[model samples]
Structures are given as C-alpha cells and as structure tokens.
Target: MTLIDDRAPASVARTIAGISNGELSGSTCAPELTEGPWAFDLGMPGYGPGASQGDLLPAGSAAQGELPERYRRASGEELSSWIASAKASLGSRVAVMGHFYQRDEVVQYADFVGDSFQLARAARELPDAEAIVFCGVHFMAETADILTGPSQAVILPNLAAGCSMADMADIDSVEECWAELEARFGTSPDESGRVPVTPVTYMNSSAALKAFCGEHGGIVCTSSNASTVLEWAFERGQRVLFFPDQHLGRNTAKAMGVPLSTMPLWNPAKAGGGLSGEALDASRVILWNGFCSVHKRFTVSQISAARAAHPGVRVIVHPECPMEVVDAADSAGSTDYIVKAIAAAPAGSVFAIGTEINLVQRLAADYPQHEIFCLDSVVCPCSTMYRIHPAYLAWVLEELVAGRVVNQISVPSRVAAGARVALERMLAARPDTTMAA
Candidate 1:
C-alpha cells in the first residue's frame, strides 16, 4: 500500500499527481520511469494547498469529482477491451473525434483525428450520428457543438478537460477592452468607410468571445488562416483587436510587413491596455495579453541548440510559439502544416519540430526512416489535453450505451446563434496563397 516504491502502481500514480500539483519537482522525477503510454491515467493532480477551487477547474467546467472506482482501478488491458466493446456496441450512432494532441490510448479509439478546425468540420459531416464525442479540450467541444446540427448532441468525455489559454480571455475582460477602444477611436468609420476597430479572436477562445465577434463586425481565425482572417478584417476596419494569443498575431502580422511598432500588446489589467491614446491610434493590430502556456515554454535557445547539434536539420514550429522562436526556425505554420511538412520530406531527412511531444513521437514512429525529435528535452504535453484518459472515455461511452448523456456540452441558443455567424465567416474566408505561413 506504500506509495513510494519504484515498481508499485500506486507509487507511479503518486509521482504523476505530485508532478501535476507542483508538489514534487520535475527534476526529481526520473524521465525513464515516466515513459509508459498510460502514464497520463493518474489524472491531473488537484491544486496544492491554499489554491482556490477556481484554479483547479476551467471556466464553464461541470462539477466532476473523482472517477468511479471501476474506472480508476481498471487495468490498461481491461480498459482497452471495454472501450473496444463499447464502441462495437454503439456502432454508427456515435462518432468520436480526437485532436492531434490527445494521448495515443484515447486517440486509438477516435474515428477521425486532426486539428481543432478540421475536427470541427468533421463533426459537421456526421449528420446522421446522434452523439459526437469530442476527445479534445472545452473550447474545441464548444466549437463542435456550434458547428453540428441542433439535433446532434456533443459530449466531452472528461468534463474537467479545458484549455488554460482559452480561459485567459474571459468575456468581461474582452468587453471592457472593447469599451476602451470605442472611447479612444470615437466609434466612427474612417473616410474609406471602414469602422474604427474590428475584433479578431483566435480559434483557441471561449464561445462567448466568438459570440462577441459574431455580434460585432468581427470574425474568427485559426493558426493556418490567421493572416487571411486579418486581411479580411483590415478591409473593413481601421484596426484589429486580436485575442487569446498574442504570439500568433505578432508573428503573422510581422510576416505581412507590419512593423513591431504597429503591433502593441494589450494588457487587460491596465487602463487603455497601458497604452496612450496616440499609441493605440497608431497601432494596426492590438494583441491581447494571453498565450498558450505550452507553446510559451519553447524558446530561441532551444531552436539554436537543435540547429547546433544537428547540422542541416529542417526546423519547423507552430505559429503559437513566440516571435523569437518562430523567427529562428526554418519555417513556422499550423499543426496541420507541421504534419504535412514531415510527411513530404525525404526518408533520410532530419527534423527538429517544436510542438506537443505526443505528436512529435507519433511522427517519429510513423516515419521511421527519418530522424525526428522534439526541440525540448523535457517530456511536457499539453496538460489540459492530457486530462482526457481512456478510462474517462470508457466511462462516457458506456454511459451513452446506457442511454445517459452524462457530460453533454451544450451552448445556449442565444450564444450559439451569434457564435455561428463568426464561425461561418471563418469557413468562407480564403487565405492568400502567398501567406500560408
């Protein structure tokens, strides 16, 4: 029953929990000891002592306590067998969509696997499926719910799975920022007939913010089509207000020949985002003070080291990374682009990719002829995406088989109406051929 033995199952669980809760230092945890495929099954640890409940749960998350003992105590073999049986029982009535960042165990059960926008589109194609089980984060499920028909039910396997980056740009803070912009810009269209400002939210944002964009004259953008979305925005507005991720905005705008001076960071805590009226007026793209914690961990130093160690290595990174890292890499694009780049390379090519470890490892395994590795040595995955385990997946699927939709993620009619408008605009937006990156 002791939780410290190296070979014991309970000890492995304890180590995972400690690492998640920040109780046990990552340096102290042996990397080799944590190499198992089912290591994420221990579940994300509760926040350490004195941390508020809000810190542990994402905004809009349902009340989910411990997983039932039947699921928690099930062996990997049992869970896999159970999941396969459940899927066989459900048949075509249900379809599971997994993101690129999901664990191999959970991903193995997915009927379709791709990036967020691609998965959202996949949900749209399943018109006959009654239940769409989204094995990604909260916002992604929300997007799926918004895209699918009204009769279709969208379920998030683990209610606790949510994106930390999406939570950063809440509705209230965004509305407040809009008010300040209106005050400074006078709410009037320029001589060319475009408005003073247009809000552009990243795909990794809350549905409420998407609704905000829909209600206003704004639209949504993904990493692949952000530059195109921005071009569409500028045609109708004097300035753009990008949210939930500053790095993508900066790097994309910089590529379009917009200088750094024209792109200013908008700090929500400060009045007028800590910018003078003149500064705000001069800015073309006002980037919100939010970023992906996982992508933020990548640095220029890591890229330099990868190049130094492996000469002539083709370095590719995601746009979510900071400007410095994106600049240093040979090329920067979306998750879909990274996958395609690796797939198209020669068999003997070497690639050092800066993205989630799950995806990098999968690429390495898929393209065994190539030497592929992650830029960072640390074994860090997207903690939120890792929250969805096969145990939870089995639980939800079994519940559905029992005719109970336990963790359905439903966007209210009022919100869905507005959010759909922005999403539709995104679907229609065609990115410029030269600006794919």
Candidate 2:
C-alpha cells in the first residue's frame, strides 16, 4: 500500500499501457485510473477543481498508472477478505469511520458510520486506535486529524477524494473577502457592542478557512447546527460573512426570518463581491459564491414533478440546495435530519428526497414500508465523495495492517489550534431541537 510499491496487477498495467497508447478510452480503463490523474491527463472531464490534479494526488507520487495498486484489480470477494483480514490484523490499532453518504461496500467495514461531525467525534472517542481510516473526502479526514489526538493518524482512503464545494473557498479568496469587509466596516465594534461582521464558515470549508474563523472571532457550523451557529454570530456581530456554501447560509438565515434584502451575495471574483456599497452596508448576512454541485442539481421543477407524480408525497431536501428548491420543498434539513424524518414517518409514507443519490437509494432499500426516491431522476451522487471506492478502502486498511501509514492527513498544529476554537464554538452552540425535515 506504500506509494512506492507496484501494486497493480498485470491486467491493470496492460490497461494503463493501452490507455497511454490511445488504444483505450477512459471509460474502458480501470475505474481507479479513470478516476485519478490518468483520466485528467487524457482530457476526460473531472468533477471539480482538485478532482484530477493538485492536492488530490499524493505529494511526490508517480503517474497514476505507475503508482502502487492496492486493490484496483481485486475481485469483490478478495477485497472483502482483504478488508476483513486487515481489520483483524490491526485489531484495536485501527478504526474505520464512514459517512452515511458512502457506498455500501465501504460503509460495511466502518467501525462507526455517521455524518461528518459524528464521525469526527467518533475518531476522538477512539483513543486507543493509532490509525483513523476515514472513508470520506479530504476535508473530513482533515477534520478527524484536527479532533483526534496527535498520536493518531487520519488517512483518506483515496487521495483524490475531495469536496468540490469546499475547494470553492480557498484561504486566499477568503482572506481577500475579509480585507474588503474590514475596509467597509471597521474592525472595531459599534456602539451597540457588536462587531461589523462575524466570520462563519460551514464545515464543508477547508481547515485554513476554519483556522481563519478561529483566528478571528468566528465559528464553524455543520448542516445540522447552521442556524444555531448563525444565531450565535448575529448576537456578537452586526453582520455575518458566511462562506463555501451560499445556499446553506441563505436557507438558515431565511428560516430565522432574516430578510432576503439583507442577505447579499459575495463573489470573490468581482469587486466587493459584485455587490454595491449600499448592499454591503445593508446586508446582515453576506453569502459566499459557492454551493454543493450535487445539491445544486436539485430544482423546484423536480419538486413539482414529484408532487405531480406521487400525490401526498413529502419532499425533504438538504439545505445545501438552492434557495428556490429549498423553498419549494415541504422541509429542508441535514442528511441526519432526512434520515430521522423518514424513520418517524408513518409506515406507508412516500418521500421525495432531494440529496445525494446514494443516501436516497440506501434509504429506499432500508425502509421497504415506504416509497422513497431522489428528487432528480438523473443519478447524481457527490462525485467527490463517490471517489472513495472500496478498492481504495481495502488498500489503505491492508497498508495499515503492514504498519505503513499512507495518505495520512495531518492538520498543522498552528492551523488546528485555531480551527479547533471555531469547531468548539459550534459544539457549544446547542442545535435547535426541531429538526428541519
């Protein structure tokens, strides 16, 4: 599983050779190669900024085809056996955590399966485990690294697994936003004892942005606790600058009765984020120009179609969805909230869920008593999250069993110290008892 090892089987190697020779299309290549840098170099479209290049790949790693093959060619049974054997070999030394949106093959091996925040807490709870193999995306692994003890190593099964939404708000762009805010609204608090703006970042953001929040008097928030976190911000500051996902900020603020006129969009590319000075001055919550691609795909028309086709159907969407879509749905909440809503519904209840397809499909299968389907008919899973294949999971686990740590994600102490402050604030901000969905 070490980066230097040649793990790919002869079949996979030959496939890669074929691809290089222009004899094979990406669709015909091994899934691992097609999903990694190889596909990017071959002019295949990728999901997001870092999908096929940059931070997605390990530092100093060779070409995707030349890199070690952990489980790219393993049969289903072989993968299962390898995973089981690795888990057994590692015993208490390793703990695997999976998000609810993860595929069944990967989730099946998780020691604890839950949302991003829950899984981070799970990592902290497992003090004895030396390694925390996170079967999610890069940001999640970074969060686990921040929360867990220094001795514990957090690993993302696949280096390419990165959140597109999170990548939208980099540290440089956010810092620039902060500078503009400072110039517009002085750094000092007003006579009412509230600062001009409070920086509130969604958990979907990078650790650097989280650190920015911590360094300032800002806080971090999850989908489940966003509203509560925002409420906390307003009390301390005259306005809030929310980042990474504008929809989450907009939806949460809207629910709190914050007027739409006061929530202005901030486009980093444009001067003053494309807002007039008047708009900036009037804004109570400034939303960053970003969104979850998966959630963004959901629309009001999808809701209309669901209602038309399935009479009396309840529509529940994630807050990451566009404001129009969220407004159209019967309810909006986090993935956990959606699960709880379905669990509490009557046996024969029909649900038109607007979120990741994998979660919806799993829910449909889990609750045979009710009818459930994604709002969008087109299969749309989080491309970044879906990057964490079972093959990668098996490879990482097996590597751990061999006492080699690969793809370890460690948040620098300087950054972690600041990020932890914001995360702790969210933890302290008690979430609203009423679930959205």
Candidate 3:
C-alpha cells in the first residue's frame, strides 16, 4: 500500500495563505480562494472559491448559509485541536472520507483518503459507523449516501462544495436528451439484441442522474472504471449517450477505437442536442457538453514546456482532461493511476502530472526521490474540493460528537433505489485486476 505522508511539504491552503499575506511569490488560479468559503455563501448561488469559481451555477441552485462566527474566527491551531478532540470523542461512531483533490488541511483529518469513488467504496468497510463525514464535493457525499447503509448518515463538511461539471448535466436536461434520442431511434432492440442507446453517466454526476441510468438500461462509471463500463454498454447497446463529463466519455471511447466521426458532442442548451438528424443517426457515443474547470486548464504547451525543461520527464494526466492533452501525455488515467505510476517508477525518474494542484503537490512531496511537478504551474485546485476548509471539518466533527448530523446528505429513497441499480452494475462490470489506462 502506498502511504502518502500526512506531513507533506506546504499544502495548497498554506500556500494560498502565504501568497495572500505576501510571504510567497506565486500566482493562484483564483485569489478569491484565499478567503473562507463562507464569504461566498450569501453573496450569490455559486461554486465557492478555487478553480470552478468562474463557472456559473445552475438556476435555483441552493446556497449555503453563513457558518457560525466561532468557526470562521477560529485559529488554525484551535481548529486542529478541536477536530482532533472531536474525532477522538466520536471514536468508531464516525468515519471521515476525503478526496484526493481536497486541501491537505482537511485531508489530514480524514480516516480514509482517496478519489470520490474510492472514498465512497471505503464507506462500506465502516458499516458500524453511525455517520460518514465526507470532506469532498456534494456529488461525492451523495455517492456515499447511495453506497452506504441507510443508517449511515453521510455528511458534507461544506454544503457549498459542489462539482461544476456535475452541475452541467441535470436530470431534466438528460431526460430531454433521452426523449429526443428515443424519438429518433424507437425502443426496439436490433436483431443482435442491443438497445438503440445506453445512457452512461460519470460517477461525478448527481444521484438523480445515476437513478436515471438505472431506470433506463444505462449504467454508472467512475474514472477508474469508465472503460469497463463503456465496454459493458457497447455489449448491450448499439450506441451510448455519456453524460456530465464529455472529455472522459470522448477520451475513453476514442481509446476504445471508436471513431471521432461516430462520437458527437451533445449540447443540452440547444434542441435535439444541436446535432443534425444525420449526425444523430451516425453517433455511437453522444458526449455531453461538460468538463472539469481544473483539468481543462491543461494544454499541450504545458507538455512541451515540461519536456523542454526535463529531457526524460514522463507525463501523466487524468482522463477527464481534453483528448488533446491526454493524447499528448505519456499516459492518462485516474488519480490512482498517477499515484501507482509514481510509486512504481525508478527513484531518479522525472514526472510531470496534469491534474489538481493539491494532489500533484502531495504526490511531489510524498516521493522526494523523484522529481514530480504539476504540468500547469498555476496553483489551481478543484474549486469545489477546495471549499472543504479545516474550519468546516472541525465544526462538522464537533457537531457529530454532539449527536447532531449537520450538513447531512441523504439521497431520496426513490432516487437511491434507481441509482443503486446502476452503481451495482458498475461494480459488477469492474475487471478483476485491470483498470482504465
């Protein structure tokens, strides 16, 4: 097992703080990230701070209320001590799962730290826990709610922490797209017994979208299992309509030898997905018009820059990046893939990673024997993931210790039932040892 040093060199949070105080000389993707997330809670309904700060939130999106003044004004040492005491008090009653993109301030308190899907899966291992405090984005908490037992209350440290890419594909838009596709190609299966279209939603989406896939003959896929899920879809459907993250769908399909001509981008803002009738008929994979703000920052030029700086540098990026970036890199896969690659590499190897700044920085610090740096020098992290401040973690954990479940995320039973079908399908389709490359 690879152990990431909890005491890894300066975290993103500390760097941002240092930069804001003029003690550090580096550019942050968003200066707004320097403020506490609560600062945006009342201004407008938006993704608070970080990389996704520029991305617009959907209409009628819920806004978080002001955090208590005590938490906001608490000192770092005070918050850390409070969190430790709360965790010690709660003991086995609660399990905290953190995502790789989360800032180290919050991540250090996590009992289990990994990607969203991996963290949700980890919830299963703590069946006796009364509550799961997920220090990730909203979708991640929803996922844990779906996967864990009903008794395990899944709590999100910050209610405003939401994935912008996931917000791009809503249940209404997906249903509309499905209706259009169904009208174009009726419900009849071909003689080969494959449905006309299979809805495939990335794990980053809302629970409602996962439920939609279950209600339909669709399935759910994580970044690690996207290829396997797509293969499963192809076996049962003539074509696939992948949603929430277009880059993941497109890159995965293209890697599977699906021609670009057969994969069309679906724009929900326009009627009929803004594609011609001929285009729809020819489509094998219909990708939604969505992308991760953080991942989208990476460009081919970054690869060239890294290569120029270090002659034998190995480049690796997450599949959520645009196809061009993935193609330009030495390899592309999930967060786990990048971690495993570094763990397996020679001590003298140089690596340039294209992903969130938090994970890249953590990885670089964890393996000091190798030279690891982020392809994009800008200190941009997943905006939503960055919302989880240590203050919020301390507050939530203290609440849990008091027998109160603050910021608890509970998916509706109806939605969870449908989403479970798709999630179980994803687990079943996962290969024994192989993962997406």
Q: For each candidate in the order shown, give its overall lDDT on alpha carbons.
A: 0.79, 0.78, 0.86
When summed lDDT is taken over every stretch of 10 residues in candidate 1, the lowest stretch is 46-55
Better of 2 and 3 by lDDT: 3
Please count the clashing residue pairs in each candidate, in the order shown. Answer: 0, 1, 0
Alpha-carbon TM-score of each model against the true structure: 0.88, 0.87, 0.96
Off by over 4 Å in 3: 1-9, 431-436
1 or 2, greater by lDDT: 1
lDDT of 1 by residue, 1-437 (tens): 11122222222234444665587765322332233323333443431111011243443444355667787767667778788898999999999999998767677789999987688778888999999999998899999999998998999887666776777788999999999888778777978999999999999998999999999999999887888899999999998999989999999999988889989999988877898877887999999998886677789999889889999999998888999999899898888888888888888999999887678877887788999988876656676676677778888899989998878999998999899999989877854434435
Which one wins on TM-score? Answer: 3
C-alpha lDDT of candidate 2 relative to the true structure: 0.78
Ranking by TM-score: 3, 1, 2
Name the better of 2 and 3 by TM-score. Answer: 3
Residue 99's lDDT within candidate 1 is 92
